[model samples]
Target: MVLPAVGDVDRMKRRIQSPDYRDWRKKVEDIYGCLHPVRLTGLWEIADKTSGEVLKSTSGHILAPCGNRRESVCPACSDRYAADAFHLLRAGLSGGSKGIPVEVADKPRLFVTLTAPSFGPVHNRRFTASGKQAPCRCGRYHHERDPLIGQPIDPDGYDYVRHVLWQAHSGKLWNRFTVALRRQLARAAGIPVREFADHARLSYAKVAEFQRRGVIHFHAVIRLDGPHGAVDATPSWGTTELLADAVRAAHAATHVTMKAFTIDGVPVRFTWGDQVDVRPIRAADAHQVEQADGTISDDRIASYVAKYATKGTGKSEAADRPIRSRAQIELLRTTEHHKQIMRTAWDLGAPVVCPDCHPDGPHRVDGCGCARIDHCATCDNGGYIPGPLDELNLRRWTHMLAFRGHFLSKSRAYSTTFKRLREDRQIWRFEQNLAELGVTADSVTVINHWDMTSVGHRSDEERELAAAIAERTRAARKHRYQTERTD
Candidate 1:
């Protein structure tokens, strides 16, 4: 590999030795360890918004956003995002952050998993009731890390069409399920569905995870709260058992009827798959004590959900990068099954000619012969209508296997929001910086005008140095935590 220039190295040393190096380093610390930092150049001023009196001003300087949420894209930013997710989930369960009342820990909380129905049989690791390894349907015992575990046994028989359609409408299905869950809860409590809102409320934070089979499943932390949300007490009828029952009933009953559209002259309807799993979340303090029936721990659930929040389909046989063209789709590094699904999406997204119009035939309008309109008799029903395939919007989400929904979502009452947490962090950092600078202010406003300058590392040597620094920082943090535990 080509080495870094000697002049560049000397300049870097001089910059590091500069009098303002410490301040500059602190300013860029947030993005210093990022694999790819979004560099920006701008002038900034801290002034009074009301009086327009400038308190502080800075000339043009380089800044980094460090806002990426994907670990594969930027490890530093993703680590921060995951930490925020952990706090958000843990606060909802333990109730020590974001102004959530501590009594929320006493509420009926559940760590539920809602899965996508199986489109077809795939290679899976099967276990007997006694926790013994069992042979898969294909007559072989698969390993825990088997690459073929999620691949279809019969690729040709796999339902790629419904799979993509289900992925596309997964968000809608979740919405319907939530509505049904509230109704189910009301019915179980012997109250009218309309009156359910007056008695209790449901709050949840969910993260979508892609199984090895390339299908998306939701892992959610669902909590039953009082009608006024975290502020009020839960009703007497709001028990963990009742919540579990409602979850099962809602998952079984919920379905979304896709808009009527023809796919090769046949109508298609979408619904959730048959597989659904729901489990109660124990108290955080008691999470370590496992139940006889293999119950999930609250801490484990929080960590699991948080971990997946920064992940993508790359863990499985799917592409993390967007597939914008036929060439990209064909060149995707995935299993044959995943490749086929991507191809189906691309094929569906391609524009098709109107079935009513024939290029070689004459128009029905008198002397109009308008070839543009498929139905010349009336412009109302003319031209090409989006078929079921086109309605899927496959091209926009081809990289996600046609899933267009966010990987992480939450109800309004589900603890604190990502935005709130980020804002709090920003305020804390600003305060710390002000203290370091020996500045005191009752109120201040920051005005910023930034333009994109550059992104990523300047050279492999710089990337290596940044990565080393990041690794060391992580190690130091880990060591400190261990030391605290030991102490």
Candidate 2:
């Protein structure tokens, strides 16, 4: 075959050596990384048409394996995921191609907190005015360094089982509460519950948190969207106080549908307790709350939610690396304070010993004070002994039952989703690529599939190959331009 002109060869060589060429090639590969593995290989079949099917194929190494978390497991992929999430959330808060408008900031907004009901009285650190110490509920003037800060003072009396059930149903409880809220809002608006969606819409972003006792609490940024959505304006009747009132009414009136089951001929029903709190979302309020007890900041709230989204219960050693098995318990590197809790969780998960054949007597903690025992000096002996370690184990056990999900959970209309926004972004990028290549058509179709198996630096030989490709593209462009000039 006849080679291109000498000038074309020289131009190609220079383009291959250019830094811009290298950068563009890297970005093209990065886009491929954003695609799923199966789709990446299929992209090779897209016909170039003008270029006789430029079957650009690689070793299929840049694709992500699965769900990305910024945790130590996959930092590179996690960073990309976080960036995408940031843009997705911000777009809803501020108008983007997703049709969100800037006026969203002025809408009625509230930061609400709803909590699980009291399981039992715990050792709470009470502080008086001027920061003086008040006696704890345990009747001991516990110091700041006390180990029982959150431990239940009455573990046996505590409704640990109920607490666990609350967690499993918390998501459902929120749904019921929202329904009640809409009814209340409609009553205030002088409209029917069925017509409420047409007048004003409620939009919110919420995150679930596990308190020290393993009780799940919710923190949310609740916003009032206009009749239709972000594009429309809020109704004349809507106000922050009205929203707050509706929230309060919803909280007081809402109840979860409990499952009724008969255990050993005893009929039982489960339900949520009466602890609930809802507050307005204001930076000033958080500052005021912080003055008394450092309130959580926005960044703190986001980070806290993000951190727990990847974690499961502390019971499963594999679920959360922090948990330790019996064999690995000795390898704990935490302070003496945390070790006590960790050890308790491990010991509780072990199998019970055979009553007749055991040398160690029992596989349990071998405690002198049993929770089931009736009368002991520490407890009033009415089977009321409250062991702190046992309480910790109960907390862990309850968490395993309740919070068996990722942290951030919300309804369909809470906000624009990450996947939808990401797909839109990919479409925009593809369009931009078509525009740069001067492929203008009334309706262009994308045919290539992208696979992103890797995300870091390429080997030297691969870089050289990419560089050579860039040079050829550059020379081809120059040759076209020169010919057009002669014409």
Candidate 3:
């Protein structure tokens, strides 16, 4: 097969003509075509622990995974993340792997969706209960892929400040929700709230997703286990109905009062939207995701939820890196709505370098140069001052609407972690290297020393080639999986 012409075709041809091209191809496959691979030139040795004699030694360059979880940044790394998330979630739900007991399969579990409250009316495509298309308030049925569908009809009235604050504090809101859930569980079980842990444990794996409107929502698999966790038996009072009730109550009661952060001197109280969905999860052997029964299949739930782990803020709506300046926001080639949101975040996040307030350096509120009493065109407006947002390092996450939290998080008892999964993969590759080196010594110490020469491809041609390789690898995996399933 011939390669497509891309990026300085002569340069690409020169790269292909090199003697090391074959080895380079193999390494790309090994790393799954990482977009920005860290080039490490190093020496590693397997030596006898007791005798200090080297059993095997190698010195060369290696391509390491970038380890970015966002698909917009690196598809290969994102696929790896999704796969790890699947294993981690499935281990908790199915309870046969990752040291989880099989008994957890019988535990009461729920698939919960908590949404962001509406800041304003946005154009959206909706469907009725009978499956007919409903006309939007804009007096027309929008095409499914319409870019305007998620944007507000009246942008002036939209609560952008509150929305950004909610996104920034969503992590803390989740933390509060967990606490409320435990309280609700105790109330339902008729036990003391403080001792709820003694009776039952709440374990969950959650993923944050961005809605088309640019707000965040949460998809979580919440499981009710005994005090001892996955291995222990739940109390007799624990049931699917009770867990669902507790979830609903917790969702209602879980609102965070942003006392430290204010809007117009009124603290913003953030709560989940009205659309709360709770459904039970079935066993791993279920035939379909949505069975004849109301419950969903555990087999498909992991991959389904894990897919969001690789999603960006919103496709084409946000950048892959943190916004460095306001000029960068203006230069982004996306919709005006998204850019405006980013601009708002940036304005409230980063400090302005004014000659009056920050004569020495940039300051947010040190000398009160940007307050309502004085007109500062940069950040402060009428009755809107982001007091603690600057202290929160909001500028560092302006690209994500000031949301500074992990996309995927879980309780400690909720199965394996990403670190453990990556370590296991490294160990497996290490053993394979040992086998290749003809080293049979069981007792040996492995030492690795490497320094990064640089990050990313040296040229545009190399980057394009790497991207194509990653895309092809992803396509092949999908095709093979489908083929196996069909067979």
Predicted structure with the largest TM-score when compared to the true one: 3
lDDT of 1 by residue, 275-346 (tens): 777777776665452467655566666777888887752253667677878888677767877888888877
Least lDDT summed over 10 consecutive residues: which range in candidate 1? 376-385
lDDT per residue as tens, model 2, 1-487: 9976764345546655877656545653443332121122334322356655433333332333334452333333444455454444444444444566767656676667787777688777788998888998878887666657656786667655455555656777777878888899999889999999989888776666656555567766677777777777889898878998998888888786443523355643433456555554333223232233333333334434344443322212222343434545456443332344344445433344332333344334555334345534543333333332342343344214334344555545545776786788767966676676566434343355565544433444344554444345446655985687521
RMSD, every candidate, angstroms: 5.1, 15.2, 6.0
What are the per-residue Cα lDDT tens digits for candidate 3 across 245-353?
9999999999888677667888879998999999999777776777666799887888788877776422437887888888998888777778878878877775445
Per-candidate TM-scores read 0.85, 0.58, 0.89
Would you list the C-alpha lDDT of every candidate in the order shown? Answer: 0.77, 0.54, 0.83
How many residue pairs clash per model? Answer: 1, 16, 0
> Can you give the lDDT of residue 442 in candidate 2?
40
Q: Model 1 lDDT vs. the true structure?
A: 0.77
What's the residue-level lDDT of 37 in candidate 1? 73
Over 4 Å off in model 2, which ranges?
Answer: 1-47, 55-59, 70-85, 94-97, 123-126, 129-151, 262-277, 282-318, 321-400, 404-406, 428-487
